[model samples]
Target: MTRKPPPDTTPDGHHVVIGGRRWRATDPAIPDDVGARLRVHLMAARRAVGVALRAHDPEAERAARDRVQSAKVALGERGTPWWEQSPEERRTRWQDGLAALDAQGAQGAQDA
Candidate 1:
């Protein structure tokens, strides 16, 4: 299988271009470890959304989507534009986001 190339970024690097569409890019300032964890949560939440949809569970789908939003916002791909935020704000955003996602994972494990 061939892997797709990385998306092209705008000159300013705040957004990526894919299929002639623009999407916010993840914050460059995020540490590698934190970013990886956030991506894990994002993918898991996405999978959960699909599972919920297949089961016809609206409540579960909503919850999964909420997780997706949280992960995106934490990664600086959503909410306030990362470039517009101060350094401290950027750090806090990712740190808090990781904490929240971690807690959610723990809670889910316990429930299961």
Candidate 2:
């Protein structure tokens, strides 16, 4: 029978700890400055992705504006550069933003 390992370690024996019910690797701790900078970069990246997705999904222009605004709220208008943001954050924001734009465009076309 498969048994659950202690919360301090993974089933495979990797050292991990539960924080807020999420598993985190105990080794290789992230520095506070690095984490803070990462957050700033993430916010900028989210905005840039929304902009790029707007090109393909013309209908999403409005939502793109909203997303850019949210990211701005988190990172501010002159926060970290979008180029420095992580790729994963950018991709996720893009997928959601592009879909929103596509829907908006389709709805507009239907109305016309």
Candidate 3:
């Protein structure tokens, strides 16, 4: 009897292919510390989206999506691949993103 081959996936966890179809995966270049912080931001943004929806607040919803986008860009999932960037470039990308998030939080606090 013939046996089926196992699915293929990249060692970096950035992609997997099964049945001749490709699928997306999270970027692997994110350091563990940065990854944990990004995860917290992502989850909070996602919850904000849900909360905003319940409250029928369009502005809050948009802000939450922007937060999610920023976090994704920081993780190199939305913009250029993190693996493709030099160490210095990667550092800049993440630092810029984090600064923006912090500014947003500060502005939000001032607004409230």
Candidate 4:
């Protein structure tokens, strides 16, 4: 399968335009390994949201959505715009997010 090209970002590199819609871009400062891990969490959370919806489980949906928000914030796609933060703050944001997501995963495994 052919892979799609990366989205086009604004001249300032703050947001990406996809299908004529603009969205905040992930922080460029994020290390590739860290970013990949965060994306994995984000996708998993998204899938969980879908699963919960299919099961008509409101509580599960809410929890899964919360995870989605956390992953987005950690990726610098939500909450305080990454551009507005200092380098140190940006680093802290992603690191803290990763830690929280990891903890959640651990908790989830125990629950299962």
Candidate 5:
């Protein structure tokens, strides 16, 4: 839900404008920290994929990069933001990605 408009006037004697309408802090539908952390997680995930790409095996690296891209799209569409997602959801995604990476690494090891 959106924040209710504040009855008080803005500094210029106008209603606070946000998202094309007046807005207030009361019942803030979104949190600053949540957005910040989501960006951080997204950055970290991107970095992980980059590191994976440096691997010697081009095919394995491509798979890891693809997984990262898919994860990023999913996170963006979640609406509530990644950091705001429940702990279980976050942990599950992390574990799944890590597992995929581990598998790729193991395959590389076998090839070596």
Candidate 6:
């Protein structure tokens, strides 16, 4: 027999209980597709940071951390929510973030 996990809801999605402290969960206003894409970037950067640490490469670690920050910002967890912005403004935010990610990839290729 198996038992189901307890509920995690607070007000938004799920309340993350860590060391007896409650924190805001990931931003929910992010569109599904964009959220998934950003998570991919976040995970890749996280892994890269770990690998860089093992390899003792501080420059690569810093770059990977930058990627992690960018992904979080784009996913609406850093600054104001995208939906809260005007239409034109929201579009610009997405474009710039995504373009930066692409540029990071290109830079990685050049470095390799």
lDDT leader: 1
Cα shift from native, residue 56, model 3 (Å): 1.6
Q: Which lDDT values do the candidates have, in the order given?
A: 0.99, 0.46, 0.79, 0.98, 0.49, 0.72
Between candidates 2 and 5, name the one with more favorable TM-score. Answer: 5
What's each prediction's TM-score? 0.96, 0.29, 0.72, 0.98, 0.34, 0.68
C-alpha lDDT (0 to 100) for residue 94 of candidate 3: 76
Error of 4 at 82 (Å): 0.4
What lDDT is obtained when candidate 6 is compared to the true structure?
Answer: 0.72
Clashing pairs in 1: none
For residues 1-112, write the lDDT of model 5, one tens digit per residue: 8997655545644234665665422112223554344445456556756776676666656665565554443333332344455766655554554455446556756976
> Which regions of candidate 6 deviate over 4 angstroms?
1-9, 12-21, 80-91
As a whole number from 0 to 100, the lDDT of residue 96 in candidate 6 is 75
Once fitted onto the true fold, the runs of candidate 2 whose alpha carbons sit more than 4 angstroms away are 1-80
Q: Which consecutive 10 residues in model 2 have the weakest lDDT in total?
A: 22-31
Candidate 4 least-lDDT 10 residues: 19-28
Q: In candidate 5, which residue pairs get closer than 3 Å at backbone N, Cα or C atoms, i.e. clash?
A: none
Tens digit per residue, CA lDDT, model 1, 4-69: 999999999999999999999999999999999999999999999999999999999999999999
**What are the runs in model 5 whose C-alpha is more than 4 Å off?**
1-61, 67-80
The candidate with the higher TM-score, 2 or 6, is: 6
Q: In candidate 6, which residue pairs clash?
A: none
- Cα RMSD to the true fold for all candidates: 1.2, 14.7, 6.7, 0.7, 12.0, 4.2
lDDT of 6 by residue, 17-106 (tens): 555676445555556776687788789899999999999999989989999889767765567655467766655665577678878877
Question: What is the Cα-based TM-score of model 1?
Answer: 0.96
Sorted on lDDT, best first, the list reads 1, 4, 3, 6, 5, 2
> For candidate 2, lDDT tens digit of each residue in 2-109?
997756655543335666354433112233553354345445446646765757765555554555554333332224333344756544444443455445446646
Residue 73's lDDT in candidate 3: 87
